[model samples]
Target: MRKASIRLKTALLASLTCVTVHAWGMSFERQERCIEGLTPKCQVMILATGQIDKDSPKQFKSFAQTFPRGTWVAVSSPGGNLVGGMQLGLAIRELGFNTTIGNSDYSPPDCLSACAYAFAGGVSRKLTPGSRYGLHQFRGSDQAINAEDTQKISATLAKYLDAMGVDRRLLDYAQMTTSDKVTVLTLAQAQLLKVDTAGQTSYARWKVEVTPDSKLLAINSSLFTVGSQIPITLGILPVPGQNNKVACLIYYKSNDASAFSASNPQHFEIGKEIYPLISAGNWQEKTGGYQATFLIPDNLLIALLQAPDDTVITLSGSFSKPPQSNTTTASTNPLTAYFGVGNLKNSLQALLKR
Candidate 1:
């Protein structure tokens, strides 16, 4: 029986391995559109976890040619092709295309490794409900990369992420640490990382009730949780509609707390306030409720450890300035009418319970 069980486990793992390497297990409609004969649209629906190698070079080359004007290459990959994936990530910078992670159809979350790379490249990035981005340690079959190589990889990735406009701090999370491999970013973390976070808009995103007069002032988060990552979901009242576009400043709290002094604080932008900084990515229920996860940078974790239990999660919001000439005042989203921080949690708890 033990032998049989081992065989079963190995079989399952092998099956999953195959799925992970190739961009299989997805149901998507390929949309054919080109811009300036360079970038092309590769829209996809992520119904299951898998990799993407199909026409990757074509997609990469196209984006490199047409991306400066915001051409998008849609994708639905659980993530695969690390080297190719990294190359694709680099292409986003070279091609200059705004990336997209959701297909027109309702799809499962894009997750793990390579998919996360592509998701991060969204010019106007997004992490809708079903949308997900995952991370893991760098690994291979025979030989292993040394520490120096990993550092080189980190530096290269830093450049890639910088080009994507991700929080500079997130680069630390993107680095590979353990060979075991397993880093998934929940929706809450996605918000903290300032990945374009939209609830249920693109696929399976958190749904915020907004009214005709609703307006979200800003979004914020605490520092990334140490030891283990904590999921966080920052709120934005007037989320982008069908387009799923969002832009804002994401303050990455350094793991080194000394850099942030209370008397002469430099953490907050404009020195307005301070808070913890959590990683960002799409978070959904593994079984029930939301599950957010991201690598906790050592520095942010250190700061959080010293923080008090009641430490308010400092944050900020940047509402796009209204039309300069509009005479009308504004209203708020009824769904976002909560009074306190706990209120949002309570509401989410209630939502999860339901």
Candidate 2:
């Protein structure tokens, strides 16, 4: 029985290796059309079902040349040929085209390993909803690269990322993921690195819901709990002067000192007024503006959202004038909202029970 089991294990290992080796080659089918309903000015090129190869650059350049400048190239690949991938990426960058991970049908797709290199070359990159970008350490057929050559590759990649305006920290993330296992970037990670550069309009059309007000606050979820954090993304108009700061103030009347004690900063001050920053520990600065996660428990949040109508949250700071003449009255306040007492009470009551 032991001898039979050993033979089965060896056979299965050989079969798995064969499958992996077969996936390490490249082929592609290119489709030219406006994908994702983009305009003709932004023609879309699709690279689906293939690995990158020595001729990949030539193939990409040929199609890219036919399109006007600033086209979008949608890529979906299992990854192949590291050298070829980099070359193809350089060519795409040279042509000044944007890149996304998607299919000709506008379906989401994966850009993994070698494919990630080419995707990074975009003048403006995007990863559509349901799409993913994955990475892993560099590798060769023998599963090892010389130290000197590896250093050169690292330097070259750093240079490319710098030129492409991508965050260098991405290299750290890539290296952290071993070659045999893929590291798929989370939505937050992709956005933080500017890998998804789809415009504000595109994003607004997606999952974001903007308040119909002079000051807008976009909350990812209306539901909240003490156990986890919820992100509230604020869109602040550019300030009048450089380096101007905005402070978000949260006010609540609490009898429970324990809840209040848990906050990062016990107090927040702006001029003469002071209030505790809610869930201060969860606050962070993001690419465009500031985001804060509400760390207060359901009951505390309910209290803040209700009673003492005077208790309120506000954003106060100097902000740049909106460019549009019609929107000149855009609020410098950025965020000001009053939660409905009855509705919030019910929501919190149900949430805490769960």
Candidate 3:
């Protein structure tokens, strides 16, 4: 049955019946077989189980060239080389194909470790019922890594997952498990981490923008329950056709009806950086466009939410730019991109009381 759309291909690659090469004494094989009975308007290509090595990407490329865009790539394998898996995964993403754990006969199979990584690169990915999906840390042959190398690898992996719209927390959870012991995620966990997108067509997102016509710097911050320490992302977009810079100093203070008080200072930490409720003179620079992210502190976050229902935090920030040479007013028009609560005051009140 069709879950998502895939383009029909004219040419098909033959499934490999024999070993094409060997790596570390293990024979490697790859196959591309077309699923019969599909309509001419759509197609499914099954990539048979085999070890992924340096040559895997080359083989994948040859098969992919024969197919049209949006083909569903059914992958099943025990997983092998990390480099090869990443390369093949990137190619799958670039080709805009979807991925599933199945074979030419439509039988589900094991897609573990590096194979899971390739599956993740699919524009849309799914794990069929009865199919086994496994994951673990990216490690070397020795199954050990230096602290420096670990940090670098984590940063790169997180970035890749974020770009793929997969939850970066999957990396964190994977780090807790060793390579020898695979972490098999349930379908619920997979859906939570954005690893499984079957039957899902849309997701809720939050964003805030300020235009020249409206410059209140009004932030539509998403309101969560008290003591919820979630990440907050703020973005700044420049007005078109001008040399301009926009900057913001965020301030979260408990406020009465009349004024805001910063006497009880607070701090929010995200990643390795801590941002004070009142920003330091070192402004967050905005060259073309700027984005800043931070995690709300549990204690301070409670204060912001648990306070009186009428209490509000006045967000203060500034934007500056040099005088424009041309008469265009584009420079003055800045947009602040952020998430807004449906009803800022009312929503927070309801959430905090909950």
Q: Tell me the number of clashing residue pairs for each predicted model.
A: 38, 3, 3
Candidate structures ordered by lDDT, highest first: 2, 3, 1
Q: Candidates' lDDT values, in order?
A: 0.39, 0.48, 0.47
**Better candidate by TM-score, 1 or 2:** 2
The true-versus-predicted C-alpha distance at residue 221 of model 1, in Å, is: 29
**Candidate 2 C-alpha lDDT tens digits along 112-213:** 877887787775677777887988887666545667756666666665565455776788877787777888898789878766655311111102233465
Show where candidate 1 strays beyond 4 Å: 1-50, 53-55, 59-68, 93-96, 103-107, 174-181, 197-354
CA lDDT, candidate 3, residue 209: 46
Taking all chains together, each candidate's TM-score versus the true structure is 0.39, 0.47, 0.48
Q: Which ten residues in a row have the lowest lDDT in candidate 3?
A: 1-10
Better of 1 and 2 by lDDT: 2
Better of 1 and 3 by lDDT: 3
List where candidate 3 sits over 4 angstroms from the true fold: 1-43, 104-108, 142-144, 201-208, 211-354
TM-score computed on alpha carbons, candidate 2: 0.47
Q: What are the C-alpha RMSDs, in order, of all predicted structures?
A: 19.8, 19.2, 17.5
Q: What are the per-residue Cα lDDT tens digits for candidate 3 across 185-288? A: 89899889888875342112323445576632324331111111111233222223433322233322111211111122334332234445433243232332
